[model samples]
Target: MSGGRFRPLAGVLAATAVALTGTRVSAIALPWYVLGTTGSAAWTGVVAFAEMVPYVLVKALTGPLVDRVGPRRISLAADVVSAVAAGAVVLLDALGALPLGALIALVVVIGAGRGPGDLAKEIMIPEAAGRAGMPLERATGLMGVTERLAQTVGPAAGGAVVGLFGALPSLGLSAVFFALGSMVVGLALPRGMGHSAPAPADKLGSGSGSGSAPEFGSGSGSESESGERVTPAPRRGAGSEEGYWRRFGEGMAFLRGEPLLLTVIAMVCVTNLLDAAFGQVLGPVWAKESGHGPVLLGLCGSVMGLTAVGGSLVAAAVAHRLPRRPVLFAAFLIAGPPRFLFLAFDLPVVAIVAVFAVGGFCGGFLNPILGAVSFERVPRHLLGRVGGLQTSLSHVGVPLGGLLAGAAVTVAGLAPVLLACGAAYVLALGLTGLRPEWREMDRLRARPATARPTADGPVSDGSSGAEGRVGVRE
Candidate 1:
């Protein structure tokens, strides 16, 4: 592909990297800061709950708006909001005026902004992939690589900054990253990239087959090849409650029909919950209890992230050639259980590091496979709403994860809670795997279905009763 074609994808990836790095840094800095200051696990959990609840709720509600307004605009605007909120947290702390309630409120703002911002970036992925003539798996794999690289760098940097200068400085750096991410989306992307998805009635040609990118503006029209401006189809009840609910319902209905997607969401919800518990409560507590402190915590995360980057790079090269089901199953098996077990056992720092490294490598293969499947399944026009709903549902348990973990640890202590969580993780996956819908993971149609409106409802073209290929090579 020409550099022009690839530039949008590059910009999106760059923006995603910068933004995620900041998030990862905050992930470390905030929890450590809370734990250190309050010396209470329950309070730490409360802070996590405050942030993620708003994150899930806002992301769930913003899908239609993202579709109508354009992901690029939403992403840029959201990042700016995040920067300001994060900056406020740092500023308040510097002045020693930061109360617990104030900190929670600021993080809530940050989470609210992040919800749509992250969704917008994800909404751009398929379009970016098409622009570059890249396979979906490769594009998602590259995205995974970018995320892992941020994970690798962010934690280490956060730990160093916090250790050397304090949590305030690390938070200030996070604000800087958020600002940079906004700038990239604003200035680095091609002029015509990350536009709103066309309505069904618009009759615009689908996909990037013509090799023409969408114009970057938020206008309700695009210029056609004949140099005429093609107006968008009028949105029914646009900006009204009826329109938002209708769009939300459409996304929910689409999800309900896809048993495979539903099953994936169910499974992901459990894992995400467990992962949140680990990140927010169990991991930090373990670090403190084991006398490893923030430096060792960062070291473990860095080692895992580095290996995950390598794994993602390999996945980017060859994931399309792999069978989706077996790879996903194996990766989850390796990635989920052992980390908890090792930590629960209070193993030596070296042993914990090794386990994390191995687990992260396997974990890296996950997103590319799942992302490819999701992109292939959903129609392009509904990408924003569907993607947002899927993400929101999958994250439903995240807010509670920390609260549950913290309360469990406070009452029963850390090791027992860790063991129980690991057991629950295994159970959740094993139970979900038995469902017949999981077989669909390896079966995909040649292309995503195109939506066509009928008197009754929207229908998917070329998808009903079609035979599916066994792998994601297309």
Candidate 2:
């Protein structure tokens, strides 16, 4: 492990923050632009669906490819594609040549690129942490903090830019950010930052089998002999189509056996759906109806984001000492229903801001918990494919969210739809929070002892091999 210079970790965080900021900014600008131009809530939803459908689908399918090709190249290529796609939207709109079909198509390209790009960044975290000689918990906490900061600032900046200069400028700025993000990833990090060395031929079978080393916790600062920290470069022949499917299948099988992760995925899917509706359609519609326009939209988002950053910082300091289950349940309880109800009641802007800030604060801690669990439990080599699968599964409802909310608003009106969604959110949280499997969240075990590395990779003393082991705490 590298002594505490932490250079690669800093670069990874910077790149992720910049890229996510661009995406968040685009997220705000795009929907507002659609609503302003079309004056149809339904069309707004359609545009959102166009982007997210490709995002979820492509992300799901690209997991194995990310594992095979390496995250750095995929990340660079994805950001470049995103920049071009966003720039094209700006160019076409400026030329007055942007048809609805063309706009949607370009947005689709942006979403497609984002899927793999985001996954590639995520896959770099543990590797970066290991290289920096930092604990996984601290590294992931910092990662959560970086993301929250972007989320805090991005939408507000987008809204302000749209309010003062129009949406085109926001789109142009998104392209610039994406371009910058690509440069950071391509040039800022060291050569071997997240690269994997190929596995020795004789150890291939042992590395791929179920007996591979069981992941304990985030590693100590020392390099293990069994390849615990280093991902075994999949054998060269693993590039075949059959090999891809086999690896993909292994990822799925690994997920199936982990009940806690599945529970998280299911809960996240519903939450993501509701969030999509709120961010893309409901909030903007409410702002317009209230005669607040983009400035107030920016204000509300900024307040929420700033508070969320505070919450994330607090989590980084104290999360390990808190009770996981009750805290999470309470956070969800505070975060979800109130925002919808505030909108449903047509509360004052001040009231909305206050509620939103509180909700955002509670919401910030959730991701660190999720990231810690994932990083600690998942094997190093499987990070890309497994992270992709889990994220894709959790995002499955995102495309439907905007579409459903828009259609509902068009048919029944906004207040009723808001109330209905709020009620559903409460029920979903309640049901899942009370489930037996969810108890697992409260019971994650710390690493017992160090496992020695073998020729096959880091294997627990009693385990057969490292590749096949899926670490699930009761």
Candidate 3:
């Protein structure tokens, strides 16, 4: 069952890399197009708001869909939509027919696709790793690297491409990336590879044999058979379409039962909310107004990203040995508040860059650990549905963060806004730490029950069947 075809996996990876380029271009291109065409800074904000609203709204609804239908399908469909949207922009602009309303509509559509797109990519890594017989920890390490690089390079590349050749050309390039990404995902992935978490016989029939790992079950359907070895999945029996209310309830029920996972999700939501407020809106404004000018702003942004790269490198080296709880704790501690302080102080390039870099590094180190922790702690069956819900919740904060930051900056001084956000981050940390489940952060990493085998096949010396082990540490 573990015999995986590496060629297919390699193809997915290649597709992943190419498809990811559009993410970079979209980040810079969307804002440019909005601001340029609308000629209103306020409309720029509106466009961002419009885009993120659907991303959150749809993702919250689609978590179960991704779990049921399979990520491969979602990714394939999204890539097509993304390419069409970008192409449409190019087509409309070339003909001088692109209107602000149409542009906003497309941006929102792309944003919605992005929610599922990001989740599919993130979830696929572990599925492939499982197929290739790769360790989950190693897979997560690569996640950290990809995230750091994308966040770091994407913006600069987007800016440079847009600045030199204009938004349409850059957007055209984005269309190309999406087209390639779509083609590869649609054409290259080995059949049956995308079934990360098999649903019960009801919804998914049977997966192609990529069942959940150890602890989690997605609850789409669960019929346990004694002595069934938890390995790759089998094909599901059928697909039953249920009402949206029923599916949504099922997804929520799964999340509610997973307290440990729920905590992590909530924590992420809090952190993202605060960070988004500062990073996307306030920080940019501060940089523009701080006498740093565009060139210096770009330099500072680049430097900040590089810091994240360094942080990710350090995390990769030590993550397998680190306690999961502390990783979560320390990441938040380091990531929060510095942005507001940097703004309030209006420090020199050296000081601001140093602070931003530290913030970036902390952020880079944070997510993979959380992701590894989240995925590791749950039952395998729930990865997609749970991932969907979790991702939706985490992203919900983005728009809120932006809104909060905007209101704070408007009502209070920038310093107060940062402080308020910082305080919120701290509160989140404290609350998450209070939960008993967190104390077992490294419980899963403890020696497996068979570390000291008995007369039986394998049993824990000190723990019960499936008793928790040391976690976070591999």
Candidate 4:
């Protein structure tokens, strides 16, 4: 493959980085701003709930639309909306016309736009990887690295901006980042790179055994390893005769049958909730109560983010060779619980930073494994609906996490709430591991390379063989 083929992947990564960086910045800025202005942890949680609820709902409902309308268009539109909303917040605040209710409304708009925008970028990963001939694991790992880098940079910048220029400037910077992300997706990607994928007819129906669609790893028609001739489903979209409900139902049915996917989603729901609680409520509250403020909070996050980058790079390099189930289990063990415990104890700032660094490093291995597995199992065409549902479901608890944490802190005090959440994290992890479906993570690693009879002769889908592995080195 020529160097030019990698352009789509590069564009996606760039867009993801800047957009996520802006989000991370807002993560710090919004909570700090709310906490400082209102002096109420419950209000901070309410703001988080306002933003995330819309994000999850809109993302869940828009999967089929993404399939029909094309990811590129949806992504561009979402970012544009995000930019406008973020800018509006600062502008309204500057004019002394901003109210809490109005702030929540704007946050709702930003969240709604982020849902589809994030989904659009994600669904394009497989196509971009295929075009670049990069393996799924490596591609997702690089994506993780980009996210981690953004997390590092965004929080650090957010803290400094909030410290020196105040929260409004940080919000304005987020608007700039959103604009830049939009520009990258609109201009950097080639035509048709992020378009709706060709589907298999049986993808949405029960006719296909295992409900599996053909892998679009090559972004073109290819035979599967089972000697089955995999052909593209008829094109259906906004102009097509197919109705939206039918398309949506297909995705739902497909997701329902996947035991592994369901298991992953359930586990993620718990974790995302805990993470949101920590990031939005517990962390900031700790910062304020300790009198350390946003700078210390940002410093801890940046430390974690920096180490996570290193871990992601390592995962990208060697994840394909490692066992998925064990790595995932270990990652959670190292990454979860400890932060809460450290905070509950009110440890020295250096101790908190050190724990966060270690935890972030382990956490970095998660997305690459999960992303590769999800993409590899689902057919290319259903990426939008299926992936969207998966992500949306995983985030279901996010909105409530902050709300509950704030209420719990108010009633039980921060230390006890932190300890309770930490214990719950451990219990959730343990229970999730009891499921037998996790073995499939490693079992399916070589399934992509099975022999298939093509018109010429026997062939492979090029997933695991030398030809398929010839792309960029991790």
- Candidate 3: Cα lDDT at 229: 21
RMSD of each: 8.8, 8.1, 8.8, 7.5
Cand. 4 TM to true fold: 0.86
State the lDDT of candidate 3 residue by residue for 1-474, as single tens digits. 444445555556666666665765665566556545654444555666666778767766765676567778888888788788878888988999877888878877877876666566556765666566655556556544554554555556666776677668777887888788778877777666565334222211111121122332433323236312232233353223555565557556755755666666566566666655654455555644565533344445555566766776787677767766777577657666566655676577787767767766775566545554454433454455555666666556666655556556666756666666667767877977888877545664441211110000000000000000111100
Regarding lDDT, does 2 or 4 come out ahead?
Answer: 4
In order of appearance, the predictions have TM-scores of 0.84, 0.85, 0.77, 0.86
Against the reference, the lDDT scores of all candidates come to: 0.71, 0.69, 0.56, 0.72
Of candidates 4 and 3, the better by lDDT: 4
Model 1: pairs clashing at backbone N, Cα or C within 3 Å: none
Residues 403-452, candidate 1, lDDT per residue (tens digit)?
88888899999999989988987898799889998766554532222222
Cα error of candidate 1 at position 412, Å: 0.9
By TM-score, rank the candidates, best first. 4, 2, 1, 3
lDDT at 109, model 3: 81
lDDT of 4 by residue, 1-474 (tens): 798889999999999889878887888899888988898899999999999999889988998888777788899999999999999999999999999999999999999988888778867776787688776446766766776788788889998898888888999999999888999999988766656334223321111122133343322234556633354544554324557887777677766756877787787778778878888899999988988888888888888888878877787778878888888878877787888888988578789888988987877676656655564455555666766777777778888988999889888999999899889888988999899988777766554422210100000000000000011000
Which candidate achieves the best lDDT against the true structure? 4
- Each model's backbone clash number: 0, 12, 28, 1
Model 2, position 432: C-alpha lDDT score:
76
Comparing 1 with 3 on lDDT, the higher-scoring candidate is 1
**Runs off by more than 4 Å, candidate 2:** 1-4, 197-242, 446-474
Candidate 2 per-residue C-alpha lDDT over 309-357 given as tens digits, one digit per residue, 9 for 90 to 100:
7877887678767877787778777777788888888677789788878
Candidate 3: segments with Cα more than 4 A from true spot: 1-4, 32-42, 90-96, 165-169, 195-248, 291-302, 407-416, 447-474
